[model samples]
Target: MFRQLSERFGRPVAMAILTLLGMWLMVMVTLPQLQMIDYSFRPNLLPAQLGGPEDVWTLSNYVTLFNNEIHRAIFFKTLWSSVLVTLLTLVVSYPLAYYLAKVATPRQAALCILLLIIPFWINEILRTYSWFIILAFRGPLNEILLALGLIDRPIRFLSGDGGVMVGMVYAYILFMVFPLYNAIESLDDNQIRAARDLGAGNVRTHWRIVIPHAKPGIATGCIMTFMLAAGSYAVPALLGSPGSRWFTQIIYNWFFEGGNWNQGAAYAFLLLVLCIGFMSLVMKFFKVGLGDIAK
Candidate 1:
């Protein structure tokens, strides 16, 4: 009877079962995060005293968020840094993806793609630490520059915004590349040939034929890279100095070191909500849904 019902449902029953299972898994994993969310809304002061019950509910956490300019600045700074990193990734990955898709032979394309994957095989912390060595004051880059007479002293790259951006771009390039590659691979090469055959110039052919087709992947890559970059705590904390700290670093500090989970949760939820809003805005502007990109 179950088999017959599943067959009659035409895969939907299977999907529904899987969906429910997935939701259950997600809820289980997220229970602690949900507790944190609940914790964020509680009033920290004037609670558990003066006959107040534990977990006193209040909106002051969020209200304090709105009232605090420093927190707002951190949020916007993180947003901007993520945006910049995503844009840089897209710019760097696009031509590489285009070449791999349109020009490179199968063997060569496979090799290039392999190079991108090679970095991930190493521990991510190892990769970030490797950059620290390269970018540090007494590192090889500085030595070489000194040899070349570029400067009298070592340059400061490991503890600045420049180092943070570099680390972010390196870490997130694969996210940008694979999506663009997929989009470009799915494009009908015949249409491009047709455009060329009709005397359409390269610029015209690309703008009229390729750009619209690849829009979904562009959107996907940007959204993915931006979200990951913005939420990353390790890269920023490792590479950046106090003045250049990313907002995730701030949230992590508040949560772990400061022992103020309420503020931390507030910060985290704001970041989450902002990311959702960014993706929604992108989808609306591009007229493409996440499902469209999945194909």
Candidate 2:
């Protein structure tokens, strides 16, 4: 690997890049996680109380999460909602990605990709706020539905998880699409043609060849989409109703509003762990190995 990198970038440059990567891993990733884990176990102390007898490590922060009924419910709701969002993104993106990767001409695919990326030129917060406006009670969407006689009255889209889910799917759908596209794009077209010529229907061809070959992309897209949806703060904050507060909001409240860093860190750490466990279950169900997903 070092030799290849040196041949490509020269030895000094390759060594410098490797050194930077090592520093990034230690400083940006490992150290912050260690700090958060440390804080999660310690007491939430005032400046004066810190390092005193009452500042000793304890499990009370985590205990609070397990004991609080409302928080427990919110956490579970957020978890399942994120899963639902991931599934919805997969369904929406797979066909589009397949078309881009397999069916669309190069020019057509480039145009479509450009269109998809154009929306991202705007800031994400502004995009989410736009969705918030569109989903309002008398907003354009509800008004359109009413005009089309789909419903007699304006629907309160923001009253529950409806608005949040919509925003989440819209926000994170591209994360699923790009990964699937990358994976499918690398596949050999000959295999697909041969399958079709051998009396295979579209469904069978895809089930046996396309999907299995795209498993890595599916795994990568799902993991990234799920994690982004779960960790998202701005979309839910702007688009969700009070009744549909996300778990991240609770973490924010603990950290800023409640002034309890210990509890906040505990909640944040629990969220990370739960997401990993949930993704593990998903991987097992799909028979996808961690190595494949990582690669």
Candidate 3:
């Protein structure tokens, strides 16, 4: 349809029409998201008692964000944990993604890729709960450890960062794997063959050819995995120490438990902004926009 329109109406007109249509579509999607931004800064006071309607303007809500220690801690924890998770996922996923995309046979490649995707099909919450079955004191891991005489008692895997990172990596592995895999898969195998044929060894071929080609995918996978793992609530709630709460859990507390919607909105907005900024940084560094994956 676009090709026909370009021929009939001329390419520039067709481009203009498509651009306008794209903008309209974007506006439709983006307006509500922007409204969330507006709501984040909205005043918490009821304006009917003051002078006007409920949505009357005020900066009090946003100001509270800076004043709250609980809010500060949650934000920091989420940011720090996410950064660590991103680094870990990159280390774990890159080798696996590279091997699958570059070295595996057709059937082995499909099976390996399928193994990564299979867990994602399960509900995330259920997957997190499944970890409880493995890590709980009375769980199979504990039973096995005791039988092996590795410890006098069960280990507290689910009570700290160890459990949280494990669950996070489990849930987010696909995000890391798929992007890196797609990025590696798109490279021309002939380049690798030529490098090998020219007497470049395995290490040289990968270092000079494979890693450069897979850079975008690696960046994308890290960005996505970090974002999702950081913002996630249920896994942290289930796996993390109740005393050491996650940021998302804290946000939930503010919204529902604390009965402070304004503060909750502020927390959410801060998280969203941080994620966007990181994504922009990744795009700038990689010389590829987030949309490039789609392209």
Candidate 4:
């Protein structure tokens, strides 16, 4: 990899770029993770109790995650919810990506992409809060339904998992789309044409030809979407009711509301482990390598 980069960019420039990247990984990614791991192993200490002899390393933080029924439920709930979100995103994105990459004219595709991107220019918090208005009892959706005589009373959309799922799907749908688009756009049209000429239907053509070619992108998108959804705090917090407790909210409570940094670190580290495991599963299932994803 270094040799290829050096050949393309000249040795000095490639070396400089590699150095910067290495520093970025170490400082921005590796260092914080190592610190979190360290913190996770340490005993929780109050601000007034720092530097005391009782402040020692222990596995209690990890043990607490398992022994506590609430924590265990929340952990599993977050995992499953994230998986659901990834699958939903994939189902929603694949057709759109196929359209943008293969069917639409370049100008039309560009316009579609621009429309998708326009929402993100606003603050994420504001975007999430907009769902509140749409889902609120007297909001536009309820008002419309009432006007259409679909229901006599407004439904409690914001008080259930549906709203959270809707918000999450909307928030992270683009992550899945862009990767799928990149993979599909590179496919040669001849392969698809040949498949069609050979009497394959639209579904078969995509299942046999297009999807296989886009495996790397599918794996990449699933990994990214799953990770982001699993670690999400904002969308759930803003859109979900107290009953719709995401594991990230638990982690936030441990760190901030509960004032238990050590436990929070442990929870955060476990979440990281869950994401890594999911990525590994995706790579294996898709039969793709890390290098393929990096493309």
TM-score of each: 0.87, 0.92, 0.82, 0.91
Candidate 2: global Cα-lDDT?
0.92
List pairs with backbone clashes in candidate 2: none
TM-score (C-alpha) between model 3 and the true structure: 0.82
Q: What residue runs in model 4 are displaced by over 4 Å at the alpha carbon? A: 1-23, 47-52
The superposed Cα distance between candidate 1 and the true structure at residue 249, in angstroms, equals 1.1
How do the residues 1-295 of candidate 3 rate in per-residue lDDT, one tens digit apiece?
Answer: 7899899999999999999988987798678667666767766555455444666666777677679887777678788888888888888988898889888998999998888778788898899999978999799999999999998998888776878888888889888988888989999999999999999998998889887888888788878897898789988988888755778887798789987677777778788888888888877887887677564
Model 1 over residues 70-146: C-alpha lDDT tens digits?
87787898898899999999999988998899989999999999988998999888899888888888999899999
Q: How many residue pairs clash in all the candidates, one count each?
A: 0, 0, 0, 0
Instruction: List the pairs of residues colliding in candidate 3.
Output: none
Model 2 RMSD in angstroms: 2.3
Query: What's the distance in Å from true for residue 263, model 3?
Result: 2.1
Error of 3 at 96 (Å): 1.5
lDDT of 2 by residue, 49-91 (tens): 9888898889999999889999999999999999999999899
Best by lDDT: 4
Error of 4 at 267 (Å): 0.5
